[model samples]
Target: MLAMIEDRALHTDLALERPVPALQAISHDPSLRTTVALRDGRRLTGVQAQWAYLEQAAAWVDDRFGADADADTVEVLQRWESVLTRLERDPMECAREARLGRQAALLNGFRDREGLPWDAPRLGLIDLQYSDVRPEKGLYHRLLARDRIERVVTDAQAADAVEQPPEDTRAYFRGRCLAKYGQDVAAASWDSVIFDLPGRDSLQRVPMLEPLRGGRDSVGDLIDASDTAADLMAALAAR
Candidate 1:
């Protein structure tokens, strides 16, 4: 079922990567539109794209689980549906509800995985995940969230990321590999790409995990000021 959904997403107008920017662009320019196909064979556009996907997911949950789903899963799905319904009415409340619901779902997953008692006080996990909601904890929370629900990257940055590598981390090295090797990069496994540096005697292997630590390694000012691969490499090397 997961594979089927993923296949559909690949073929449909589902902007899975950097979706916030895509939605924003669609809102501003009709020419930059995207559509999502509904279960009824109807294609919804603009702001409806995300909602349609959520509705489809909800439908899948209902169809698969029906009345036999565990209590925790059913409760989480109910909350998700409620949040979706509130999208047209109270978006702020909807966001808050969704967060709480996600926290609940995460707790349930953790409990099941660890074989912990269901009644255990796992709300502390939310704080551990999101930290305190203070300004000082903003970066921590953003780093933890990453591509989940966080908007760590700006819309412009997200848009550019689709085509070019982020010029603020080790991803720049991967981009350099792509530029130098072109189609040869694909010959390397999907997990890591090997690059032969101009001056280095040995081939360098760039891992796909490079960008994951960028938030911790990159200085805000340096990332903002970086305009070249050299700048990013210098910043990363400094760290």
Candidate 2:
């Protein structure tokens, strides 16, 4: 397993070294070939892009463990070293990304705190309007009751809360309303994104990227674990 993780890390390193200017080229990048995008319209800086590459690689490495394996599994704990190698390839990348992130954050904070650049894109959000496509409101109501969601949401602001929410419980019952009516719904759902370009009153819809988030390291971990498991299995089978 460790060896497998090492191999994937090597590949990621190779990808980083053999840089293609276009972020789109990542789709063709050898190993996982998975896609990532910042919460839809979000763009990543040089460092964020680099970290995201390793993070996903780490996630794939970790995911290789058997279902029963706990986080404490010897294999899981040891995987950190593999992750270290991948991220440490160029420590400056981390620092660089951190600096960029902080700068952006500071700028945003100033915008909010001091109210500078009212003309700047003012923390736009995709205001998803719920459509009735839930199974039943019971389960959804139960889930949405959590503080994280309830804090921002008010009463069922969408269609008549169906007795049974749409087949897709999470989507059909987002903050007590479905943004879209459909049988298949995923909790990892975002309604038609409303992008408020700077200087626009009404939010406009724009193309959202796949993978609502970027830079999750689960994929890298899983890949490493799978490689380890496969090697062990292969060796055992050969014997």
Which candidate comes out best when scored by TM-score? 1
TM-score of each candidate structure, all chains considered together: 0.30, 0.19
Any runs in candidate 2 off by more than 4 Å, and if so which? Answer: 1-14, 17-64, 72-106, 115-239
> Candidate 1 residues 155-205, lDDT tens each?
698688766766666565455545544544434543566644455566655
lDDT for each residue of candidate 2 in 138-180, tens digit (9 for 90 to 100): 3233334442122222356343444433332222223222223
- Which 10 residues in a row give candidate 2 its minimum summed lDDT? 123-132
Candidate whose lDDT is highest: 1
